[model samples]
Target chain A: MEIRKKRRICLVVAYDGTNYQGWQIQQNGNTIEAELNRALSALTKEPIEVSGASRTDSGVHARCNYAVFDTAVRMPGDKFSYALNQRLPEDIRVRKSYEVSPDWHPRKCSSKKTYEYRIFNDEFPDPLCRLYTHFTYTKLDTDRMNTAAGYLIGEHDFKSFCSIHTQTETTVRTITDLSVKKEGSLITIRVTGTGFLYNMVRIIAGTLIEVGNGKYPPEHIKEILQHCDRSCAGPTAPARGLTLVEYEFL
Target chain B: MEIRKKRRICLVVAYDGTNYQGWQIQQNGNTIEAELNRALSALTKEPIEVSGASRTDSGVHARCNYAVFDTAVRMPGDKFSYALNQRLPEDIRVRKSYEVSPDWHPRKCSSKKTYEYRIFNDEFPDPLCRLYTHFTYTKLDTDRMNTAAGYLIGEHDFKSFCSIHTQTETTVRTITDLSVKKEGSLITIRVTGTGFLYNMVRIIAGTLIEVGNGKYPPEHIKEILQHCDRSCAGPTAPARGLTLVEYEFL
Candidate 1:
């Protein structure tokens, strides 16, 4: 009897995420993981499951999300993108796929993730940008937002910026870069970090928005971090404004 | 007996046309005009009909499409934008509203209209931009497209570029400005003209795309214009790439 050795494959996926209930599989609604599993199963003629690197929130988009699966399929790894894309919906696309060592795992790898939160700061909301941007009629001060973001850099206890529902054991994380840039009527907040707690980026965005709108002083972020309480930070920004821009495995 | 004078109101409308069946009222499917009429009737307690400046095709977006309607409602013209927006779907928005003279008409007046056609030229399609842009895997030559567009910027018989089903009496029109620009992986063709025949802009986009792809020489546009036959030009481009950018009454 000959035994077929199963190989591990890594996939870089991109999705609009408007119709998805997040990256994790849930019983109540559609999700990116569920769709990927269904498409992979249909393509390989087996019940396939994939583990994602990030469990993105509902309505959060992703330009590059990492996922790994083990399969016994005989097809070439590079061809998986084309084959899986044929079975996926228009809103979801497999950007790239490649073979990985059997011992490699997505979640256990050291990676740097970059997120972008977009805000359309204009008197009226742009209908064309409604799907990707969070619209605000109030004017925002970019300088103040940038000042507030500076305090969030380096290793710190991010409990105040994490959602209370998170099950993670530790709230310590390191933010490498955080910037607030304004171009015309659009304000973009780009944050790069080693890892994130649940809803950490969204909470940071919400806190920075408060500073931009003059509700809080830029220096107040230091106190929020010291408190290390979820109630110390601002509310979580809407999920629609957040997007995972890049994921670089170290 | 008190008499309320009926005033003609002009609306500057904007919409994401992905889910609409064009600007004109139709019985087959949902349309921008039908939604407007429905909202207007509900707001004014009477039947309302609007005449659009351009009957844009399905999947054609608009930043500023003009529509005029007579209303007996006592609401101020500027307030209509706010009121109508509340009832309209998120894809459609009333940007502004103002009162026009009773004798003023949108289509009858001399005006300059600008349209933009966007193309995403890359090895792979971007799912985030699929609804708003046309995607082509081929690398396009911008210099050739610009040269072809230069030949289109003058008064001439555009029968070669007009759709065969056009109901217009004449195919002659004056193009004020035509330019093709490439930024990153996206190409934008901007055209401003006195008036456009049915499917004229889309046909022009298609013909220029052929020039850019090396299918036709840049100078071939001159011969196409002189032929004055629809078959002499390239096929009409998809409607998703075209957008009505501006409409300025002279």
Candidate 2:
């Protein structure tokens, strides 16, 4: 009897996420993973299920998300991106694909993730930029936001910055960098971390925005982190403004 | 009988232009003018007709498209922007509105117009930027493009760059400035002129792109302009990349 060896393939995906429920499969709505699975199943002539590195929430965009699946198909790994893209919607694209060790698991690997939250600080909303950015009529002070973001770096308990619905065993994470930059009427909050709990990035963005708007001082971030309570933080920023921009596995 | 003098209201309008036919009143399709007329009629309680300064082609965007309409409504001129925005679609917005002299006409006045054509030169198309920018996989030489563009500055007969279907009797126009700038994978062609013939900016962009791609030499623009024939220039670029960025009356 001949045994066919299945190879593990990792794909780097990019999606608009405007019309998708999320990166994960859900019963009620369409998702990036569901479309990917359907396309993979059709291409490989096998029922394929992929494991996503991050299960981003609905309306959250990603420039580079990671996913892996095992397949017995004879097609070249790099060719998967082209083949899958032909069947996928325009909003979702497979940026690249490569072969990985069969034993490699996405969640088990140590990785660095980067997210960017965009804010359009203008008197009126820009119709062209409304989809990807959060609109705020009030002016924002980037210097204050950057000062507030300084306290978030390094290892700390991020429970206050995480959604209460998260089921993570531990809430401690190491933030490598956090920056607030303003250009014209656009403000961007970029954060890089070892790992994040559910809604961590959005919550942090909301807190920083409050600091920028003078509702909270720059020092308030310390108090919020020390409280270790979700209620101590500001409201969660909208998902539309946040984008997963990078995923680097070590 | 009390004579209610009709006042001319000039609007500075902005629109995404992705869904509209153009800035003119079209019989078979929706347009920016049609929407403005509808909103004005509802707001003023009287029939309103507007004349547009530029009848932009389908898929072209505008940051400031000028339009003038006469109405008997007593509402403050600046308040029209707020009132019309409430009734208009999300894709279109009235940036500002003010009362103009009854004799003032948008097209008759001497004005300088600025148009920008954006090209996303990358390995693959970015879905998020698809609506506002034209995507090209070929590498573009900005130096060559800028050199070609330089020949277009100053007054000249733009017959070679004008569309054959234009109804204008004269193709002579004065170009104040023409520049090609590149940032990362994005290339922008910005042109400011006293007046433009139909499809003039788009044709110039296409011709400059050809020069950037090595299809034509930098010195070819001088010969093309001297030819005084439409066929001497490159094809007209797509309307999606063109935007009316500014309109300033002298």
Candidate 3:
């Protein structure tokens, strides 16, 4: 019998996600996880199953998402980024890869995740930025959005902002920061938090948009949070506008 | 017998250009001009022919391209923007429309044209900007590129940079301004000129990239210009990275 040594490798992944079903494995659709598995398996000749830090929804892009997998391949940690990049598709890239402790789990570790929801607020849609930004002709008032975003900071039960289809033990999450700003015709809503429930960020974006259009006051965020009902909040923003821009493990 | 009054309307058009063949109409492939004609014909119930100020190549984008057409639709010149936008696809838009002199022609009018060549300079390609930016893993020196761009200013015979396939009476043109700037991972080369030969901006970009990469010194641009041979110039940058940003009738 031959004994093989395994080392856990973590990757900083960035993907377009427009063509992907989602980050997780699914039988019916092509996904980011499946692609990574295929590429990793081909590289190491092992049946590698990688675990993702965050399972981003369909059509949602990410600049930096983490994933960890055990491999017996002798390739050094940092060199995996360069080597895996050659094997991966153009839309998916391994930005950085390194070896991690055998027990260090990406999802189990405490981390601060930052996401940006982009809104193209203009008289006409710009084709250049159409893929990443959600087009809204109704001029958004950033001031109102910022005021509403402020209320969501700190620990709060985000049940109202979560999807009804989500299955989680608790709906409570701590949002460290939330902000809204506009440059030119692009409005960016950036939020950083320790964790998030299903569709929490997007639903929050949708509610803020309502506040921006003057349909609701900034203080309405408090009421929505207090209601603890999904129906109270605005509709979930489109998946295309959301991007996982940063994921830092603490 | 009923007769109609025709007005010459000039439009500021913007398009993504990713899906279109080019700005010019052809026997095959969908073009921006063809789309405009189809939309205008549908609106006016006439076979309307639009004259474009610049014939941008395939896969080239534009924020402000000019086109003029004669219409007898009884709609006000400015109002045509709103009406035409409804008929056009999401990738194309009419930014502004106004009445011009009946005899005025887009191509015949002396105009200053400005173009931008975008390069995404980074270790890995950004999926978000993949469609609009040319990805270059090589680190570029913008200062060197700017130095090279300075030599191209003022009136010069650009025969060396002109494509061999292009036909024109004169190869002399005045470059009003040329600049290279870097923001984050994006490098933009902005060039404004009285007129340009076919693939002029793209070739300039390619040559500047060589300057940026230290393949040639900044002064090499002058030598290339003096040579007045297309073979002396660098390769034409990809059309997807180029955009006709501004066109102003002087």
Candidate 4:
């Protein structure tokens, strides 16, 4: 008998993480990855272990995310999205799916990731968007927040911006872009980078918020980066408003 | 002894209707209106009975909904939004609250109401958006759908579009505007009217969908309207994706 060839597939997924622990495999009941695997296994009639490009934290949202899985089922690879989405939960969907080389690893591929943080600056919370955004008070200086974010766009030792408990050996990462804009009572902070340290985006948001509120000078970010001391960074913002927008393979 | 006058309050509320039985006060386990009343009553230390502009069906969303109530509480009406929102569930919120004319009736006021219907026109369902949108197959013709919607505009006896179980005494209503557009795989249908018959928007969408799929000609809508028979209309579309975008008071 001939050996079965493994077919690799790429996926674009969107999720509301309020109910999930995170994307990784865990002993607990709910996980985006576990749900995906279960859905895929049911669809493909086999055990399909998938690997996600980023292990996004719980309470995060994603408009588009990438994941890869290998399956030896009889179905064509192009039809995988339709098949998998049918079995998945409504809040997490496979936007699209495609065939890729078996060696294409979702994590190892060279690319950039984009994340967005939303702040509801209004005095009252928007109940409809409560689960999808963060609410905050205390006036923020847009100019100062913008100025502080400028210091983050480039290669740097991001140790100060990451959680002290980050498991990665090196906290060095290249930030490609950062921006802050306000629309009505909503302030949006967007960041794109080659990679990120643990809790980096949320920490950056919190630090920038301090600059906006005049609690910290815009130039303070440079010092925080130079010191590489976790204590120098601002507190971690809440996780509700963080969204993993996308990952691009280039 | 002098009697303190009662204050009439108006509120702009928003909610995620996934778990509740819609906006009305129901004898069932929970309702958005009941929850808001509970929170408001608890905060003001008074019995409160709030009336909503629309009794939205279960699973329907509202971005800006109006409600009015009479109370002799001591709290300032402007701050009612802040106070009510603090105690409301994470899924329901009061965006703004202010004192209104004692005669102001949320449902009686003649205003343009805007409603939007969303359909996921993809081959597969999105797990993340499952609870928030409706999924349908068969390619849709947006231009044709828009053309058909034109027949719904203007004053008419809309008895055929109203559900048989509607409690309203009159089925005559005016549909000021109707439009349909497709953004990628998402088809959004927006309707503006002085008022809608019971289940009217969903029925209109369902009937238009038939036209989009070529099962019925655009002109067929005119015939259905003329017949004045609910059976002549298409099936009522799902309630999940419909949203009360706003109400204009002039």
Candidate 5:
């Protein structure tokens, strides 16, 4: 007799993280992961628990977020995306789905994630895009931002750049690429990394904005990294301005 | 003895009509206009009212919707937009503001309005854009859709093209321009008119889709218009695909 492999489901999710606490199994208040659990349970008529790749903080966004869950349903993995999307809210979407091994975990997967931070470098605020973008009146030198970003391209001890409450065994991670570009009033900072600590991207963005605004020189980034102290870094940028754009698996 | 001047506040409003009934003040349920009234009353400390250029139906989108409200407040017209956006939801925004003459009404001003309908003509529905786009799998003929759209241009009696429940005094309207373009799996229908009746744009889109799907020839649109019978027209398209792009004040 031929044995059929057990089905493990993988979900690619997109969400407006404005309202939720974060993408985690929160015990208090609302969270994107909790909502997905509710939606998936309703769709599959079973208790569907999921583990997300990143526990993105409140007010953050994800264009191609990932999650993995195990289920014994007879539906094909690809068909689960359509079923889940039909039950999800307008702000959250299950973009893709696939089958995986029962041991597969979104958080444990070997992957490189790309995040983009948007800053509206304008004098007046845009009413339509206030939620998704950060507005600053001071002129930002994109060249300066780019120059500062280049200093942190290699693997480094990012303890000084992460949040104080971050619970991680390793503070070392590889930042493969970073670039800044301006279009109209929008300044987009794209960063690619093997892994990021809690509030790591936001702190980097905040420090870069400081560099762009002349508060800190591009060379100051080198000192901050060498010190490995959180106080040496700039303030954390607001969560709304940061978005997880994409992720590539190895 | 001095004459009191009337203050006409021009508003550029944007909305995601997924939850609300539409841009008009409907008695059935919630609406963008009604929400605006509530927000305006809280801002001005007066029961403010507004008239929209187009009473878009439920689930329609607006990039720069037009509205005019007459108020006696001492607040500057430009500042009203800024203040209102602070109190509005993330999806709705006031893009701009201006003061116009008392006679310059958003609904009555002689100009043109542009509406775009997006059709996701694909085999599978898009998970990322479930709410913002309409999905169809009939394999539309762009040549036929474009040819049928051309017949809609110029002044004509659009009685059969509009919803039967439209209670407008004029069934005759001037459609200044109509164009259809296909990009990959997306088909965009751009329509500009002096004014539109209830469900006019959606009905036109449905009629064009019929022609593109080979249910009717491109020439059938002209015949449908001449019939002046509601039954001769095609089905009404869903409101999700329609977007009020902008209005040009000539």
Candidate 6:
């Protein structure tokens, strides 16, 4: 008797995330994960399920994300990106694919994740940029936002910046870097960390926005972190403005 | 007799243009002009007709297109922007509105118009930028594109760049400036001119793209111009990539 060992394939995925639910499968609506599973099943002539690294919220885009699936088909793993792209919608795409160790799982490994929140700080919204940018009428001071962000650069309990519905065991996380940058009426909040709680980046973005608009001083971030209460944080910004820009396994 | 004289209101209009049939009032499709007229007539209980400075093609965006309409509504001119924005769709916006001379038609006076064509030179299309950029896998040489654009800067009978079906009597036009700039994966071809023929900017963008991709030498632009035939130029690039960025009356 001969035994055939299944091979694991990993994909670098990018999606606009405007039309579907987030990366996880759900009952009420379609999602990026479901779309990928459907495309993979149709292509490989089997029911294939993929494990995703991040379950981003609906309307939150991703420039670089990871997903893994096991298959017993004889096709080359690198060719899966081209094959899957033909079946997937234009809003979602598989950037690259390669074979990985069969025992490796995407979400179980230690990884660094980066997100960017874009704000169009102008008198009026530029219609062409409405989909990708959050519009704010008041001018933002990036210097103040940067100073506030600098206080969140080390290890701390991020419960204040997390959603109350989050089921994570611990809210303590290490933020490796945080910065606010501005150019030509556009403000960007970029955050990188080893891991994040649900809505942590968005709450941080909203809090920094408050600092930039003079609602709160730079030192307010320290107090919010000390409180470690979700009510102490600012609002979670619109999901449309957040994007998972980078993900890498350590 | 009490008289209420109609005032001319000029608008700085911006639109995504991805979902509308350009700026003209076409019978078979929804248009920016039709939407503006609908919003205006509904806001003020009167029929309104507008004169547009540029009738951009379908899928072509505009950041600063001008439109003027006469109205007897007692609403203040500057407040029109705010009022109309509430009635218009999210994809179209009135950036500014002010009173203009009663006879100051948007198209009759000499004006300098600037258009930019964006190309995303990358290995794969970024879904976030797909609506605003033309994706090309081939790397572009901006230096070569700039050199080619320099030849088209002065006055020239741009017959080779105009569309074959253009109804204009003559193709003579003055190009004020032309340059190619690159930032990261985005390449911008900005051209300013006194006037443009039908599809002139798109043809020029296509020709420059060919020059950048090594299909033609930089000096080939002069020969193409002197030929005085539409077939001498490259194909008309996609309308989605072109944007009317600036318009100013001389």
CA lDDT of each candidate? 0.93, 0.92, 0.93, 0.87, 0.86, 0.93
lDDT of 3 by residue, B137-178 (tens): 999999999999999999999998888999999999999999
Q: Could you tell me the lDDT of residue B47 within candidate 3?
A: 97
Native-to-model Cα distance after best TM-score fit, residue B75 in candidate 5, in Å: 4.0
Q: Write the number of the candidate with greater TM-score, choosing between 4 and 5.
A: 4
lDDT of 4 by residue, A107-165 (tens): 88788999999888776676556777788777787888999999999999999998988
True contacts kept of each: 0.55, 0.36, 0.60, 0.74, 0.12, 0.76
TM-score of each model, in listed order: 0.97, 0.94, 0.96, 0.92, 0.83, 0.97
Q: In candidate 4 chain B, where is summed lDDT lowest over 10 consecutive residues?
A: B123-132
- Name the top DockQ candidate: 6
Q: lDDT tens digits, residues B1-250, model 6?
A: 8678999999999999889899999989999999999999999878997789999999999999999999988888999999999999999999999999899998999899999999989877788888888888899999999999999998999999999987888899999999999999999999999999999999999999999999999999999999999998998999889999999888
Worst 10 residues of 5 chain A by lDDT: A122-131
Please state the error at residue A21 of candidate 1 in Å: 0.7
What is candidate 3's CAPRI-style docking category based on DockQ?
A: medium
Interface RMSD of each: 0.8, 1.3, 1.4, 2.4, 4.3, 0.8
> What TM-score would you report for chain A in candidate 2?
0.98
Q: Best to worst by DockQ, what's the order? A: 6, 1, 3, 4, 2, 5
Interface RMSD of 2: 1.3
Q: Is the docking of candidate 4 incorrect, acceptable, medium or high quality?
A: medium
How does residue A247 of candidate 1 score in lDDT?
94
Residue runs of model 2 more than 4 Å from their true location after superposition: A1-4, B1-3
Q: lDDT winner between 2 and 4, please give it.
A: 2
Kindly list the per-residue Cα lDDT of model 2 for residues B182-208, writing each as its tens digit: 998899999999999999999999999
Candidate 2 lDDT at A139 equals 87
**Docking category for candidate 6?**
high
RMSD to true structure for each model, in Å: 1.4, 2.0, 1.7, 2.5, 3.8, 1.5
